[model samples]
Target chain A: MYWEKDIETIPREKLEALQLARLKESVAKASSSVFYGDLFRKIGLDPNDITTLEDVRKIPFTTKDDLRDHWPYGFLAVPKDDLVRMHSSSGTTGRATVIFHTLNDINEWTNIVARSMYMTGMRRSDVFQNIMTYGLFTGGLGFHYGAEKVGALIIPAGSGNSKRQIQLMQDFGTTAIHIIPSYALHLSSVFEEMGVDPKSDTQLAIAFLGAEPHSEKTREKIEQFYGLKAYNSYGLSEMDGPGVAFECPYQNGMHVWEDNFILEVVDPDTLEPVADGDGGELVMTTLLREGMPILRYRTKDLTRIIPGPCECGRTHRRIERIKGRTDDMLILKGVNIFPIQIEKKLMDIPGVGTNFLIVLEREGFNDLMIVKVEVQKEFFSGDLKQLEGLRRRIVEDLKSDILITPKVELVEPGTLPKSEGKAVRVIDNREE
Target chain B: MIAYQLSIFAEDKPGRLAKVTGILKKGKINLRAITISTSDTFGVINVLVDDPEGARSILEEAGLTVSMKEVIAVVIEDRPGGLDRLVQLLLENGINVGNAYGFVLESRKKAVFVVDVGDQLEKTQRVLKEASLETLDAKALSAIEPFHYMNY
Candidate 1:
C-alpha cells in the first residue's frame, strides 16, 4: 500500500530527484501562466534553466499582498470551468482571498490529509467529528474530507454549541475530534455541567486541534480533560488549510508533505533562506497544484524546520508548532476574534452608552482588554446601587456574548476620541 | 427552612472585591449577602446571590479563579449578641464554626449568619433550633438587598 520507497525514506537523493522533475514541470507550467510568465520575463530568468531544487530558489517568492494585488482569478493556472472547489480566508474587511482547486488538486489534498490521520493512529472504524467552521474557512470541510478519505465516518459538527456537540458524542461513538484546542477546554467545562466525566466518555482516542497558536500548557490541559492525546494541526489559508502538517503519535514536530510541498525557512527581512533547525518565516512552493500554482509563497508563520527523521519513520521534513502569525491576528481566550470584534460587540448592544475606547493592557500576568464605555442617562435613573449593579451586568453580558472578558468602565459620553479612518478599535499597550 | 450560602476562594489583591462584584454586575445578578474573610495568600468571599448557577457561571467566565463551597445560613435577630447566643448554643451541642459572617435584612427584623461547619447541615440546623434559634432556608438570603459596605 506504500508509495515509492526512495522518495519516502532516502530523503536527500529523493528530494533532489523530486525537485528536478517538479522544477522542469513547474518551469514549463510557469512559462504558460500569464502572471508568472510576465514575472519570470521581468526578472530576466529563463524558467527552463531552473532544473534542480537548488536552482528553484532562483525564482521569486509570492506573498499574501501579491495574491491580494492579483485578486479573484489572476493566479489561477486553469480556466474557471475546470475549477471544482473554491475556499476563502476571513480577511479583515469583507473582501477575502480566494483559492481554487481542481479535481486532481482535491485528490492530492485528500491523500495528504488521509496520510496525516493515519499517522495519528486513526482507524477506518473511528468516528470523526469535525468541529471547525465550514463556510469560507477551510477548517471544517478540509478535516471532514480527510477523515472520510480514510474510510472513517465523519460528523460535520462545525464549532460552538458545546451542549449539542457533547450530546452528539454520547449519541454517536465519536472516536476522534477535530477543533481548536481552546474550544476543547470550553467543551471540558460543558462536559462537567452535563455530569459526565470527559475522561470516561465514549471513545475519544485522539484530538486534532488547530486554527490558532497554542501553548504547551494549554495542550496539557486538553489532553488531561479529554483523556486522549492532542495533536497539533498546522496550515494557513494561503496554503491548503489545516492539513499542511500534523503531529503523529510521536508528537515531535509535524511531518511536512515534502514530496508535494517544497519548504524554505527564510529570514523575513533578508528574504534569504535560513539554515536548517533555525526559526524563520515559512515559504512554500506547491509541486503539484494546478488551479493556482505559487512559485514561492511566503506563509509568514514563525517556526523552525526540523530536517532530521521523525520517530514515526517518515522522511518528510517537519516544522515546529507555529508561535505567532506575521500579521496582527490576536487570539484572545478561545475565540479567533480580531480588533473588529470589539466594535461589533459594542455596536450590537443597545443602552450601552457610546464614546468608548478599547484599551489593551496586561494586568499582572493576564492580558486584559478593557472597554471604557459611557453610561447613558437612562441607566442613571435606576438605583445608584442598582446602576453600579447594572454596570457589572453589562460587562458580564459582553463577556459571554463575545467570549472575551472585557473590563467595562462607565465613562462620560463625550470622553473618547473620534477617529477618521478605520476606527482605532484597539489601543494595544502590550509590548511588541 | 433553608438558606443557601456560597464560599468562594480568592487571591489577595487590592481590587479583588471590585473584580468579583464587577462580574456579578455584568451578569445582571444581585448578591443578597456577602462576606470576605482573608488569610495570608488567598481569601474566601462568601456570597448569597439571587441565582447561584448564573453567579457561578459569571464568576467562572470572568476568570476570577474561584471555587464554590456550600455553607449554612441561619437567621438571627438584628440585636447585638444575637450571633453570640447562637454560637454558644452550637458550642454546647458540640458544633464547630470554621467561618462565620452575617448580613442584616432591612425589610425584616432578622440578619442571616453564614456558618461553615464540620458537622452535618441538618444536624446543625436541628441543634440550633433546639437552642431556640431560628434557621432560615437557603433562598431567604437571596431576597435581601446587597449593601455595598466598603471595608477599605
Candidate 2:
C-alpha cells in the first residue's frame, strides 16, 4: 500500500548509504551549474569531498541571496533544453526565485508527491479537486500531476470562485482536496453563507492544507467546520515545491522524504548542528533532483527533527512544523518585520510615548503581535473614546508600515518593567 | 471657576484599583463621587475628592501617574429628565462632554452633575450660568455631605 515502502522504511544505515551515494552524484551534477562550478573552482573542491553526511557542513550554504544574485538560470545544472517546467516565488518580498525542472525531474517530483498523497490515503477511486492557484505556484501543478499519477478523477479547479468550488464538490462527489489553510477557512465561511453544511452536503472526506505556515488550531477549526481530516504539507519554491515533507496518518509530525533529501537542523546563531529534537534552522540538500541539485541550502525555516519513531513506521525522520524564519530581520508568516520598524512607525505619530513593549504570542495557529504602547501624558485623558481612537490610529499606522495588524494596548508610563542591561525590546512567546 | 478631580491612570489588573484607593485612603482624602473609565489595557480612575491638589501629589509620590483635571459641576433637578436637559443644552452649544458623573444633594430639587468639558470648560460655565443653572465650585462641593441629612 505504501509508495516505495521499502525506501521509505529502509533501515537507517541503508538510507544513509543511499543518501551518501546520491549526495555524491548530486554534487557531481551541481558542479555543472554556473554558480556551484564557480564556487567549487574557487575553493578547489570536488564531488568526492562529501564522503560522509557530516561533510555536508563543509560545503558552503546556498542562500536565497546566492540564488537571486545569480538570477534566472544560474542554478540549472542540466542544459537549458532539458528543463520542461518551472515554478517561481511571487517576487512580492523582492526578486523572484525560479526553480527549473527537467522532464525526468518533473517525473521524480510527481512520483514523490504521488507517494506522499498515496501515503495519506489518496487512491484511484477518489475525486481530487485542486483548490489552489495554478500557474507559477508549485502547490497547484505539483498536486495536479501527483493526483493524476495516483489515477484519481481530477478536477483542475484552480482557486477562488468559492460558490462554483462548492458546486463542483457536490456535483462530482469529490472526495479529496488540496487547498491553502487560509482559503480553506474563507471557503468554509462561504459554505456557511450559502447555508450549505460541508459535513452532510458534500462527499469530501480528505483535505491537504499547505502553501503558508498555519497553526494546529487553524487546522482543527477547518476540520470542525468541514467535518473532515485536514493534513499539513510543507515545501518551498526553492525545494521544488509542495511534496518535500508531509504529515502521515498519525498526524504527529511530517515525514520529510529522507530518501530524496538530506535534513540538517542547525542552531540559527552558531550555525552548528543542534541535538536531535532541539529547535533550530532546517537546512536541506536535494539528493535526486537533476536540473537543480541544491546542496546544503539554508532554508531559513526554523524547525527541529522529531526525535523517536513515528507510529506510522516510516524510517524517514520527521520534522516539526516551521517555527519562523530568521534573517537580520524577523519573517513572521513570510512578512519581514525589523527591530526598528515599530519604533520607526511610532515616531511618525504625534501622541505615541517613547517606551513600548512588543509581545509576540501564538494565537490559534497565528503569530499575534501585541504592542503595549506607553500612553503619552498629553494624550492620556479620562475620555474613553479619544484613547480608543488613539489605539486604532496606532494599529492602522503600524499595519501600513509592517503589514502586520498589531494590538496596540495603551499602558501607563513606568508600568513596563525596567531592564538593567541593553533595552529589552521584544518578547517572543511562540513555541519552538 | 472649574472644579478639579484627581485622575489616576491605572493598569487593568487585579489589585491595581486597590492600590490607587489605598493611597487616597492613607492620605485621608474623602471622595464626593468616583467614576472609572476603562479601555482594553488601562483605566483612568476619576475621583471628585474633598482635596484634589492633595490627592494628586499623594498619588504622584506613590509612583502613580496622576493629574488634577478641570471639571464643571452644575446642580440640576434630581428627576428622570434632569441629565437630559443639561445634556441637550450642552449638545446644542457644541460642548462635548469628555467625562461625567453625578451625586444627589437634595431629594428632588438639587443634584450635582460633574463634567469634564475639556477645552470648552469656560464656555460651558458661561452657558450654564446664562441658563441660570447653579454650579458648585470646589468650596461648595467639599463643604457638604448629601447623606448627612439622612439618618435611617
Candidate 3:
C-alpha cells in the first residue's frame, strides 16, 4: 500500500538523494532509448550531463506534437516484444498516439495509482466503480489496475447509462465512484429527478474526478450535492494516464508521484523554469516509464508546485490547481476560452441538457462565437412568449457565467453530434 | 360573461418573478390560471384574472410590460375529442383562432379553452353559447385556483 521508502515522511535531505539517484538512472536509460538518444545528440547535450534532478531540465522539452510527429512507433523505448499491453491517446484532431507497457511498467503504474487511492483515504474494503471509458484511452485500465492493486472489488463500470449506474450503486453498495465532474453532475441531476437524494441513499464515501479541468466552485458544489469527498487526479496518455498525482485528505493540492514523475513549472511564454510558488506551465519528466519514457514533456497545463510539506504528512510534492493552457488555438474577442470553461458554465445551469458545442467562425473579419446547446423536453412548453424570454435569459446567463458572450442557439435534444470517444467540444471554422 | 386576460413581461432571473408577484399581491388581483412559457431570451406569462384591466394598470405602473386582451373561455368535455370538436365549430363558423391555451377543471368535469380569435370574437362567442357551452367570467376563473408554477 506504500512505497518501500517512506517518501511522505522522509527527511528532506534523504528525499533529495533519492531524487538525484533516480534522476541519474533515468538519464542513463534515456540515453539508451533511441528517441531520446538521437534528440539529445542533436541538441549537443549528453545524458551524462544530467547528474542531478535539476540538470534534467537542461535537456530539451518533449511535447504531445513530438509523439504525434513521431507517429505510431517512433517514441517506443522498449521493443514491442517486451510490452504486455498497449494504450493510445484519443487525439481529437489527428491519428491516435500509442504507449507500450512492459509488465514491470504496469506494476509500477498500478502501485503508483494504488498509492494515490490510498493517499485519498480510500480503503481496500471499499468497492470502486470505475466509470471512465475503458478503451484506447488509458483512464479505464489505469484505474482498473490500481483499484485492483489496492485490493478493492472493482465494478469496471465504464461511463454512460446513468440509470444503470445508479442501480449498480444502490445494489452493490458501492463506496467509491470515479468519473469526470460533468458526468457526475449530470448523474446528480438524474438522482434528483428520481426523487432520490444520492447523498443519503448510497454509501459513496469518495469520488475521484479528472481527465478535465474543473473549478473549485464546482468542486464544492458537487461535494455538497453528492455528500462525498471529491478528489482531483491529473494525468495524460504521454505520462501513463490518470494517476500522475492525486489530492489527499487536506484537499490543498494533488501529490505528484515523485518516484515515477519529476514535476517542474516553467514560464509559459518563455519556456523557462519558474520558482516553486509561481504559476506556470507544468513540465514533467517520466522518471520510471518503460514503454514510452518522456523527458521534460511540455504538458502545457498551467500550475505550480507546492513546496514545503503538506498537513497530511505526504512529502510528495503538491501541484496547484490548473488555471489555463498557453496554446494559440483560439482567441475570440480577447477572451481565452477553453472548451472546458464553457462546459463547466453550462453544467451549472439547471434544466440545460447534456449536449453542447462551441461553434467558432470568421465572417468578414468578425469572430462569431455561438454555443449550440441542446434544450431538454421540460424546457419546452405550450407558451410562446415565455419561451422567447428564456432564450434571451440563457444568452445573458452564459455571457455573465463564462465572461465570454455567445449566441445561445437552443437546438432540439440529440441535435449535437455525440462522441463515442473523447467529446469534441470546439469546432473552429476559421481557415488555417 | 366577459373575462380579462393579462400578459406581463418580466426578466427571467430568480428574484424578478417574486417582485412581479408581489406587485399583483398588493393590487389584490386574484390570479386563476397562469402559465409562464420560457425561452433563452425571456419569459411570457399569460394570466386569466378576476380583474385583468386592474392587473394591467398595476403591472404597467410598476414599469412592467403589460397587455390586456378579451379572451373567450369556453367549457367543453374533458376528453380528447371535446377540444377537436370545438375547433371544428370555430373553423366551420369562419372564426380564425389566432392563439389559444387550455386547462382542465377536473372537479367541474370540463376543460376550459381560452381563445384569441381573428376579428370574429362576437360570432365565435355567440355560436359557442348557442351550443349550450358555459362561458366563465374573469372573477369566477380567478377565484378557482392560484397559479403555483410561476411562483415556485
Candidate 4:
C-alpha cells in the first residue's frame, strides 16, 4: 500500500548505499555550479573523493548568506536553457534566495510530494483544495502539482478570500485541504459566521498544515474543529520545499526522504554532530538535485531525529517538528520577519521613544503581535483621539513593511522591563 | 469659568491605581470624584482633584503620563430628578458627556456633578448659562467640602 514501498521499506544498509551513490553523483553535478565549484577546488576536493557517507563531513556547511552572497545564479548548475522555473523567498531579511528547477527536477519534486500525499490515505477519487499561495512561495505549487499527480480533483484555491474558498469547498465536495495551521483555525470562525458547519456541510476529511511550526495543542484543536486527521508538513525553499519531510498517518514525527537527500543534526554553536535523538540544527545535502546540488546546507531549523524505527516501516528516518531557529528570525502568519526591521521602522517615525518590545502571542488560533512603544511626555495632548491617531499610524506603517498589521500600544518611558546586556526587546509568550 | 481635572494614562494592571494614588497622597491632593475608562489593554484614570495642576506635576515627576482637562462642575439638587434635569439640558443642547461622575455635597439639598464635555465644554457652559443653572469654577470646585452634611 506504500507509494514507493520497495525503496521506502529498504533496509538501512541498502538505504545508506543508495544515499552514498546519489551523494557522489550530486557532488559531481554540483561541481559544475560556480559556488560549489570554487568551494570544492579551494578545499582541493575531487568529485570522486567522497566514497562513504561519513566522508560527507569533509565538505563545509552552506549557510543562507552563501546563497544571498552569490545572488541570482551562483548556484545554478545547468545552462540557462535547461531551467524551467525558479521560486524565491520574500526579501524580508535583506536579499532573497532563488531555487531553480529543471523539468526533471520539477517532476522529481512533484513525485515526492505526491508520494507524501498518497501515504496519508488520499485517493484519486477525493477532491483536494489547496489554500496556500501559488506564486513564488513553495507551499502552494509544491503541493498543487503533487495533488494533481495523485489524480484528485484539485482546486488551486490560492490564499485569502475565505468566503469564496468555503463556497467552493461545499460546491465541489472538497475532501482534503493544504493550509497553514493558524489559518485553518482562523477560517473556522468564518465558517461559523456563515452558519456552515464544516463537519456535516462539506467533506473535509484530511488536512496538511505547513509554512510555520505550531504547538501540538493547536494541532489537536484544528483536528477536533475540522473533524479530520491533520498532518504536519515540513519543508524549506532551500531544498525544493514541501517534499523535504512529512508526517505519516502516525503523526509521531515527519519521515525525511533519505533517498533524495542526506540529513544530519549538529549543534548550532559548535557545528558538531549530536547523537541521534539529541536536539540540534538540521543540515541537509541534496542528493538527486540536478540544477543546484547543495552540499551540507545548514538548515538552521532545530529538531531531533526519532531514535527507533516507525511502525509504518518506511526506512526513511523521521525528524521531530522544528522547535526553534538558530537565528532571531520570527515566522508570523507564514512571513519571515526580523526584529531589526521593526526597530528600523520605529526609528523612522517621529515621537517614538526608545526601548520598544515585540510581544508575540498565540490567541485562539491567531498569531498576535503587539508592539509596545513608549510615548514621550510632550506627546501626550490630553486627547484620546491624538493618541489613537498615533497608534493607527504605527500600525499602518508597520503593515506595509512586514505585510501584517500589529497592535500598537503606548506606554510610559520607564514602564517596560529593561535588562543590562542585550535589553531583551522581544518577549514571546507563545506556548508550545 | 473653567474647572480642571487630572486624566492620567495608565496600563490596566494591579497596583497601577495604587501607584497613582500614592503620588497624589504625597502631594497632598484631595479628590472629589474618580472614574476609570478602559479599552482592553490600557486605561485612563480620571480624578476630580482639588489641585489639578499640582497633582499633574507630581504625577509627572513619578514618570506617569498625566494631562489636565477643563470640566464643568454643575451644582445639582440631591433629589431624584435633579441629575436627569441636567442630563436633559445636555441632550437638548446636543452635547455628549465623554466622562462623568457625581458625589453628594450637602446630602438631599445639593450635590456636585462633574462632566467632561470634551470639545463641547464651551458649548455646554453656554447652554447651562441660558438655563440659569448654577456652575462652579476651578476656585469654587477646589473649595467645596463634601462631608459638611455630617456633623459627627
lDDT of each: 0.72, 0.83, 0.75, 0.87
Residue A337 in candidate 3, Cα distance off native in Å: 13
What's the CA error at residue A124 for candidate 2, in Å? 5.5
Compare candidates 1 and 2 on DockQ and give the better one. 2
Model 1: residues with Cα > 4 Å off, grouped in runs: A1-7, A91-95, A331-432, B1-152
lDDT of 2 by residue, A1-432 (tens): 688889888999999999999998999999999999999999988888888977887788888889878888899899989889887755223355788999988998898899999988999999999998788778889999999999999999998799999999999999999987767877877898899999999988899988877889888988898988888888887787888999989988899998889899988899889998999999999998999888888988889998998888899999998877775345454344665667777867876777888888766445678999877776665566767788899999888766668988988877777634555478878643
DockQ for every prediction shown: 0.02, 0.34, 0.08, 0.34
Which runs in model 3 stand beyond 4 Å of their true positions?
A1-5, A91-95, A328-432, B1-152
Tens-digit lDDT track of model 4 for A327-394: 87788877767787888888788767776899998887688999998866666656666667777888
Per-residue C-alpha lDDT of model 3 across residues A352-411, encoded as one tens digit per residue: 677888887655434578887765545544345444555567777767644546787765
How well docked is model 1, in DockQ terms?
0.02
What TM-score would chain B receive for each of the candidates shown? Answer: 0.79, 0.91, 0.76, 0.93
- Provide the lDDT at B22 for model 2: 93
Largest lDDT belongs to which candidate? 4
What lDDT tens digits, residue by residue, belong to model 4 across residues B1-152?
68888888877778889998999888899987888876656677888888888888899888888888888989898999999999999999899997788988898888889888888988998999999888887777678776663332
Candidate 2 overall lDDT versus native: 0.83
Q: B25-119, model 1: which lDDT tens digit per residue?
A: 98898887777765433355778777777787777666543445566777777687877888888888788777677777632466778786744
Q: Which structure among the candidates has the greatest TM-score?
A: 4
Docking class of 2: acceptable
Candidate 3, position A164, lDDT: 90
Query: Candidate 2: deviation at residue A136, Å?
Result: 10
lDDT of 1 at A74: 76
- Candidate 1 versus the native: TM-score? 0.62
